[model samples]
Target: MTITAVWPISSEQDPNAGDSMTITDPGEIETLVSRLSESTAGAATVWHEGRELADTDTQMHDHDVMALVAEGYGYLSYIDADHDYAVLDGDPASPAWNGEDVDFPKGSGVSPETLAEALREFLDSGERPESVEWQPAEW
Candidate 1:
């Protein structure tokens, strides 16, 4: 299965700042999730279908992003991927646009089986993920 991760675009003022990115590889997704968990610092907001997953901020980092991806939920990538993951600092909106913001009401929580099914649907329909409602940001 191919997973796409998109981080918000960065600005030139803070070029070192990170954003988000889509991950197409399952192995990579797992790895990213693990890394985020390990590097988790404080609580982060997790949204799914317009609902908040965590009531309190608890280790908001890369793990959260990976979790979102696993759950098939879409998020606003207004910061760098690293800051979201590793507790690093980033620019609010230096000057860039990764892509249009998206929302996936059907996606919620982590479920490998569910994600696989969605991917299969894409593959079978001969439709690229970009065409779906929760389209990933362009590279």
Candidate 2:
């Protein structure tokens, strides 16, 4: 199946932040999913459509994820990737604009980039690209 992930552009600050993706066959997806679960250090409730999938063994399908929000966090990037797995931080002047590597609390705030990655990993089963692409939100 051709799985797809979409990340919308943000006018906010933070230039270091962006979205990316890649494709993985079923076998690769399974392997990546395992890695993701193993890599899952903190905690989150995986979701399919709108239903929360508490079971780790639940096969991944094309879906949306609000892992951190479900876990009771504030933002996406700061919460997941940037905090720990995140490689860069954006400038403070224009957080979403300057793309600077500003030091920040680990796993606390959510950067758009990190949020996009987390969602990508969840949906693409960890397969990813350099940045996530998004469309206009209806609501």
Candidate 3:
């Protein structure tokens, strides 16, 4: 199982931009999922091979744990805002993280990188990350 992260890029920003990256390290995948779990306040859905993992929400950071344990690629989506959401694509076999513009159903969306970094640092330092660090993208 190989997981590649793909994001939507706005033509206004870069007409020839391709928003996708490959994540190959299992530790990095864990780091990404851990931060994602913290971002959602531990509220997120876990999917393995495109199927949701059961009994994950009830457990603490289960999404993060399940992702690490998944035999196949893992996908986690967190709805952090009314019109903003974050997604993590992790493959134990092969992984990639994409950075680009993502259009939402509401005609707007934001990049998850800032949030990921903040959460990552928070997890590493045990300090709360500030929301003002980065604002979600809008259209």
Candidate 4:
């Protein structure tokens, strides 16, 4: 659950792009996680002492991303601060990675050329390839 707040900042009209939210109760997180895990989608819930926030172990990196994609679990990955996309490697058993640079969600069985075309199209709304059947977490 997200807490919404509207603080009147006379000097600013809009909130900062990067906003920091404080979650005071650890039990709320557990409750939310439990509710989300009941869905049909694959679920991974982790619990840690509420001593710190954003630990390295919970954060995924390059190789970690490969593993996640290969596992065929649907996930929205934030590749970087400015670039984010959903990726699920075609053939979960193989480490095949293909997706657009911007926000294309590519799944397993997407050809490399098709993936490139999707990325190119995302850049400028260009023509999409006939074979690029890009979908979000369809696998």
Q: What is the C-alpha local distance difference test score of each model? A: 0.30, 0.32, 0.32, 0.28
lDDT of 3 at 33: 45
> All candidates: CA RMSD in angstroms?
16.7, 14.9, 14.7, 16.7
Please provide TM-scores, in order, for all candidate models, with all chains considered together.
0.23, 0.22, 0.23, 0.22
* Model with the higher lDDT, candidate 1 or 2: 2
Ranking by lDDT: 2, 3, 1, 4
Residues 8-31, candidate 3: write the lDDT tens digits.
333556665434333444335455
Residue 58 C-alpha lDDT in model 3: 61
The digit string of per-residue lDDT tens for model 1 on 5-72 reads 33322456765444332444434544433332332111122222222223346623332322223122
Lowest summed lDDT across 10 adjacent residues in model 1 is found at 85-94
Candidate 2's error at 9, in angstroms? 20
- Global local distance difference test of model 4: 0.28
For residue 132, give model 1's deviation from the true position in Å.
Answer: 14
Clashing pairs in 4: 90-108
Candidate 1 error regions (>4 Å): 1-100, 106-110, 127-139
* Top candidate, metric TM-score: 1
Candidate 1, position 45, lDDT: 29
Give the Cα-based TM-score of candidate 2 against the true structure: 0.22
Question: What is the lDDT for 41 in model 2?
Answer: 22
Model 3, runs deviating above 4 Å = 11-13, 30-139
How close to the true structure is residue 61 of candidate 2, measured as C-alpha lDDT?
A: 39
